[model samples]
Target: MYRPLLRLLPALLVMLASASVLAEEVQVAVAANFTAPMKLIAADFEKDTGHKTVLSFGATGKFYAQITNGAPFDVFLAADTETPAKLEKEGAAVSGSSFTYATGRLVLWSAKPGVVDDKGAALLRGEFKHLAIAAPKLAPYGAAAIETMTKVGLLPSLEPKLVQGESIGQTFSMIASGNAELGFVALSQVFEDGKIKSGSAWVVPTNLHSPIRQDAVLLTRAKNNQAAVQLVAYLKTEKAKNVIRSFGYEP
Candidate 1:
């Protein structure tokens, strides 16, 4: 028995070496709005494929600027389809490797349970002195919020009360910290288990603004990286779709 075990040790060592060689690390730039779901998905991706991920989250516009300036990201998960498309046109991303991964939903949320009503009438009521919103130029959710307010004819009157955060993450932080009584934010930020995790929110109707189509793409720098390719493929899998859905996104 000792002799047989000794003979198999060399083969087992070779197997371990091969496994280590095959595992690769991917660098991913994720949009701030998709933070929660992407964290879960990235973990699942690593566990399932034995690959590692290095994720960086930020505003989509800033990411776009960074990518153009040679950011070393292997993959990009953008808050809108336009950014990826622009990258593809500029030869900064792998052509034909882009796809919409999820459609985001916007919400009017307040940290306090009863501050916001089901129909989102709080804006009109003018009870809150300050309202937080992401910078429209930096975040798609902020643009949607602008559109919603404009369509509802509240922009002019509510302009003075608006407090702009550089990113949706910051906007959510302001509301959660009670710096702003309420704010427009990505539904994913406040939603979990098919409902709002805390506070009250009015799910903004999609018709009020353009559809927020989030896209994922393989960056040109990682064109030949196997792990990067696999990560993009993983985003399309049913397992990934389920995770996207759980965060109030339509996958």
Candidate 2:
């Protein structure tokens, strides 16, 4: 009986150690514009590593607030690089673990067919009574939209015509619901059939706006999670890059 007990004790201890090494599932706050690509990548990561992702999608600025207040997110995928850097500086993010994952594009879109012309000059024409845009103070895409308007000499004229939303998703909704005749939104939001979908849009010329360098960073909350490290590594892999590009983003 003593010999059997001794053998069983060693096996039990080994099993416990194995349990200890099992990685914790990671929680993520993702920018709304990145929703499509992130869904695909998360599925692949789960299949490859047996790790899990719990994601919340919305404006990057709002997520920053939750994280700063000690929300449980273990990773952040920001719509712009600035917030990630700020988080790192503030000790909320892990140093040296941040990287740009994609570059985003701006578009002028309308859900109503023929309401917008192919070239998007219709915005300057002020044909629409209301034009929706993301709030420049809360979302980087909003900043890009304002920059685009200023570059094209439309800011002064368009400023009064603009309606602001708190996030990209809300901007899209304003356009879709006809609350605003057209809106400035992320290009990915209008994608369909390997190209821009619905009504009409002008892919805002890249030179008109600051580079929309979207970034991802590990948070201090997930410092010890092997799954988070592995997932970040995977984002740089060709598999993940392909998915991002397919969603109309550039790596």
Tens digits of per-residue lDDT, candidate 2, 1-251, equal 59998979989998878865674588889998888889989999988887888888999999999999999988899999989999999999999889999999998888877777767778768887898999888899999999988888999998888999999989998998889999999988898668876777777879999999999999998888888878889999999999888878998
Worst 10 residues of 2 by lDDT: 15-24
Q: What is the lDDT of residue 149 in candidate 2?
A: 88
lDDT of 1 by residue, 20-77 (tens): 8999999999999999999999999999999999999989999999999988999999
Off by over 4 Å in 1: none
TM-score of 1: 0.97
| lDDT of residue 242 for candidate 1 | 96
Using TM-score as the measure, the top candidate is: 1
Reference-based TM-score of each model: 0.97, 0.90
Model 1, position 85, has a per-residue lDDT of 94
